[model samples]
Target: MTKRQQLEMDRGQDGSDSVHPLHNVSSDRSLTVYPRGDGQLVVETETLGHLTPRRTHGTDEGRTDAKLPDRPSVHGLSPDLLVPQPATLEPLDQHIRSHTGYPDIIYQATLIPPANFAMVAPFVYRSSFPLKKNFPFLLKLGIKSILTLILEDYPVQNVKFLRENGIRLFQFGVPGNKEPFVDIPQDMIAAALATLLDRRNHPILIHCNKGKHRTGCLVGCLRRLQHWSLTAIFEEYRTFSAPKSRHMDQQFIELFNMAHVGPLIDTNHLPPWPTLL
Candidate 1:
């Protein structure tokens, strides 16, 4: 399977230049192995052939300044070739803080969670766009997949990190709710919900730019699937998107078409959420 699978929705406007972007989408499912457990990535060292020679002391040989004989060769190759090169001279603290390179400093790393991060269920989490610093915290979660709602190309740094870590990306791009475009396409949300219901995507992280409007809408709809009361759902939604909660997002959750989403779910692999109907 490919590293990233992107599904997008097309806004059927008559070629009008609205602030929000629109693209076409299709309903299709992809599968990949979900790797678990914590294992360190092994970094290979370069073989270095150079060896410093030692001279004998307090002997006739020392007066002549002759070098010591080389160690025995293995398979016609010098044993010194088996020795690895020394590490670079960069400082430890600066390397970890700058995120300029991956070094052994991660052994003593500080894991920093993303903004507005919270656990939605046993294996699911929600957060704002993850930064380089947030990667250590994500590693600890053992994230198997990521579901992103931002309507832009994933960052190169993030894509590289995900590729290196064996995490799959399911990108369903959609614009955030803005005035006059309060309608978030139901088909996109329904498709996203179908993906969320499958246990294969567990240990998933749902995110948008700020984890406020778009993320809140998706989580609210999920609460609806779990048979949560609208009152409670709205309360939780407000907690994350407090100062800038959008009424349109709440409306989308209340009126989300469960009938459209139900048929798309694979009942055999549904998550073990008791309240899921």
Candidate 2:
């Protein structure tokens, strides 16, 4: 076929002359594909989206952009725990002896964090339900308490782990926010906020089924109490519970009576968060 005809066939009905990349070319990476045989020699280029970091909405326009830290503050936690330690294949005793003249004293293990884990404050963390595999990572965080928003009974394994580790469990047990009729309880959320505000509950982990809706609602309210703007609060809520965010939850946050939370907070035991209102 002639070059013009072949080019027309390649461009097809769209009529735009932009050439599609070769099958092997990735849109995200910088790679040049040299032509094979008599094929046209065209260099593949990365898209602008891949080269430049896309700024999140509301970051500009006079709104202060709150970015998540690369490493969140783990107050009172061992610095070593912040960075996961690599497991060594060498025998424990041999490795320990070689390093510090000790025998069988050091055991290296990989820490697997729970799904969707992220720090909400200095010592408060949010995530999906914890499992047996995530126990080591939780332990490393020095978590003293856990707050669960699901209405179901706690898992046996999780209960045992908390009992053995002396980690307190506070279950608020709110129903999921469903459409048409179901709604989250405002009082229960207020109570959970009181629990979160207590300094004694430092290093607490909050979770519900997927750590999205119910958990996001609770965190959204917490942000409100911290005096965050509605735009920032909604942005944070969507950050964790995107693609299926419940408008009901955002409405709940918007209309929530901070007065309910105020009476519940003990003046003497409040956390030292500077932003708390």
Candidate 3:
């Protein structure tokens, strides 16, 4: 065929001329083909645009090589493709421990008669020993005295911390067991109530090991002094002492004579209950 006819036949429908059949076309570059006596086409590709080499600056030297960002293997693909990266998820216990620093002590604690009580209510609070790390939380409450129902001696460090913070301690040992027939003594309960009644120890904290049983009994008696119904007092006790509530403690709270404790700080003149910030 004549060169002109061959060229016309090779031209695409869009009127753009195509290279010889043996040559390949590129999206961004032009292709040229030359026929040889062997009937094979020699192909040459030319880039469509001019590219300027990028220049970089260096701190020590005058000039530096251009640095390019790392690219993924499969253009447009993520670099982490097929790579088994470790998970960065935190465990549930670890998350809680990060905040509390004490994983074992998960019991909830709050001010007695809750903050919802009227402002005239006494400023009494209850919780487990303000263990070293938790002392700051207790200190912020401005507690003046601590009433411990624990039978064992107080932790020396806790006592020292209380003294350093100008907090007096009153201990009335009640056996820390759940024996159904075991009862809290009336005299001890009376004395504890008397201490609670005195305005000198206005902001008091009563606690046992877990702040459940012994503390519940003492608070139950105080609730009795406040003329709270047996149902209300028991409900409050059961709330703190949950799944492991002691029947004997409830029985003691029910049978305990409010007359033994005598008159307490009149409900009308009590200080406002403190709250957590």
Candidate 4:
């Protein structure tokens, strides 16, 4: 096998960071993973790969020099969450704050209820594998009981785990075309929420690889559906994200450039990637 392919396989096993030319994200921050008082694991949001500081180092404790950092700082997406789903920006100690009274915006997946969050698209995203490989630390910090998930073309895997644990996995097939003008598949999104109505108070975590395109489009549509002023929603998602524009992943982006790409619920227009531009 190619050395690059071998390295990727290693990442899949250890879930640690490694130096790779194709990889695009390595956290400058540290990360800590621990069993939370609740069944969910508590992970340090600010640090990416470093384990949460502890007097003793073991399975849950952390170490440094990890190749896969949980999150690379990005715009609108909360590094604090580590998992990179949308939620209200409330704590100064965590991510920067933004407020929208709606409360439905923050969520894990559209298939689940947003815990006190209003659905806004600014936190949505989509990017290809080299980036996913770069952010290796993302694999940690979820309940095995909650099930891991996989999407149609989303490079990551784990849907089976999530479904087995009672986390619902929905499929909104992303078109294979690398074109920039991605139609927001409104029907799929609406149908997903219809399923979530039973769990109106539960939280959902929605993500598509980089959490930029597919996730963003869905969040944007959800915000619009809520009659939210897109402008305000953008402001809130930005406060939490670090923002990286442009990437080398796929082709077919010119159409994305033709459209007015505003922040999800809506704020200032962050420029599209060069391919999209």
TM per prediction: 0.61, 0.63, 0.53, 0.31
Please report the TM-score between candidate 4 and the true structure. 0.31
Error of 3 at 181 (Å): 5.6
Backbone clashes, each candidate: 2, 0, 0, 65
For residues 1-277, could you state the per-residue lDDT of candidate 4 as single tens digits? Answer: 7665776786677566543323322345444454332223454434444433322223433432222334454554444343423344345433333322224335323332222223322222222222323222222322111111124543334544344455444555553223376444434554443332223213445555445544444444444444456565454334323273222111112222223322221222322212121
User: Residue 85, candidate 1: how far off, in angstroms?
Assistant: 33
* Candidate that scores best on TM-score: 2
2 or 3, greater by TM-score: 2
User: Best to worst by lDDT, what's the order?
Assistant: 2, 1, 3, 4
Q: What C-alpha lDDT values do all the predictions have?
A: 0.73, 0.76, 0.63, 0.36
Quality of model 3 by C-alpha lDDT: 0.63
How are the candidates ranked when ordered by TM-score, highest leading? 2, 1, 3, 4
Model 1: per-residue Cα lDDT over 69-139, one tens digit each: 34465445322233322342245455343433445565667889999999999899999999999998999
1 or 4, which is superior by TM-score? 1
In angstroms, the error of model 2 at 255 is 1.2
Instruction: Give me the displacement of residue 138 in model 3, in angstroms.
Output: 1.3
Model 4 residue 146 distance off true place after TM-score fit, in angstroms: 8.4
